[model samples]
Target: MTIRIGKIGYLNVLPIYHPLETGEIANDFSIVSGPPSALNQLMDAGRLDVSAASSIEYARHPDKYLLLPDIAIGSRGPVQSVLLLSRGPVDSLHGETIVVSAQTHTSAALLRVLLAEWKIRTNFVTGDATAILSRGERPQAILCIGDEALNLRFHPDYPVRTDLGEAWRTLTGMPFIFGVWIARRDSLDRSGQAVRRACDTLIRAKVWGQTNIASMCALAAERSCLSREELRSYFDGLVYDLGEAEKQGMTRFYRHLAEHGIIEDVPSLNFLA
Candidate 1:
């Protein structure tokens, strides 16, 4: 049986996708590409066998999915892309309406955790953050993630730019895990060998991307409309490996989500053996 995979269609995730899209690796996997939230929903519906899912999804449904070994899209601090664009002072957002991006999962929760910490309560609404970026004087705050957050064309009208990654690190003194690659346990359970092969292929692709960063950066810059220098730095900034530190961060994040009542409880991470 052929395994289907869903890839995130954001520039921040380009390095892991380069090898597959460019046909550098040979595989029989069918591809479904979309934004992070779409991919997460597809996985939830069992439409995709494997996917790059928001870390929060795994935390939310730990029993339904098994994490692939040693792969993540996380950051130590200041993920320039996940920005909280606020029209007023972030601390003064009491009673204001803050619009969460439809494309976000982890970021939306992260925002709530941060606000709870700051004792800043605001009414949350969901909307197309991309469309709202074009407007001014409405939606007092916007949580922009992925490629949309990478754009800095917003006017001075929305000047309060708060980086969620940086804020999380400052608040907890730990790195933040944004997304992770996950496979439905039943899918991998049915084909262990095939699953391992696919996992290795993606790991190799990540290695190839690190070695051939110039090509990756050029392609990413074209798609993101960011300068080569900026793309280079951004790619360099991301940590694609699920190391011990990232796990610790994930645990801390789960605790925060629970403490803030964003999630029911802290879910234990169960990885594929």
Candidate 2:
């Protein structure tokens, strides 16, 4: 059986998937693409054997998945894609409604954690921030992720923009992992070799991607509003590897989530052996 892998449809993930798409790394696995939240749901529902899912998904159901080692979507600081855009200062948005993107789970949770850290409480509603903004209806704030955040990073309407990754780094002094590659536990049990092979292929693809950032940026520029230089800078800040520091950051995030009742408890990082 072909291993079904899910890819996040975001430019931030271009480095990893570009190589695979360009035949830099040859593989026979079936790939599915969607936003992180959709991929998380696919994994949860057993429709996907493996995926780069939101970090919160694994924290929510660690028993159902085994993490693929050495690969993640993270940033040391200033992730340009996961942003909180507010009309005024974030601290002053208390009691106001913030429209959150329906396509996010981890970023939304992280936003709550950051707001709580600042001792701010704001109401949240789920809607399409992009559509709302296009219609000239401004909510107090909007939490955006992926491509939408990149496009709105410099919007004139929201003068105050906060990069969640940067905020998390400031609050924790470590890299923030937003997405992690995970394999369904039962899929691994049934097709162990295929699952491992897919993981190895992803790691190899990531290696090629890390070395070819310029090429990736060139390809990404065609589909993005950002210039190549901006895309290069954006890619430079991203961390694709789950190193020791990243693991520590992820654990800290999970602990905070649990403390705030965002998740039931901190989960053990169960890697595929």
In model 2, the runs with Cα more than 4 Å from the true position are none
- Per-residue CA lDDT of model 1 for 83-167, tens digit only, reads 9888788987898988888888999999988899899888989888767655643677888888878885264667899999999
TM-scores for all candidates: the values are 0.95, 0.99
**Which 10-residue window in model 2 sums to the lowest lDDT?**
15-24
* Cα RMSDs, all models: 1.5, 0.7
Least well predicted 10-residue stretch by lDDT in candidate 1: 129-138
Deviation in angstroms for 20 in model 1?
Answer: 1.1
Backbone collision count in every prediction?
0, 0
Every candidate's lDDT: 0.84, 0.93
The TM-score measured for candidate 2 stands at: 0.99
Q: List the residue pairs that clash in candidate 2.
A: none
**How does residue 202 of candidate 1 score in lDDT?**
79
Model 1 clashing-pair count: 0
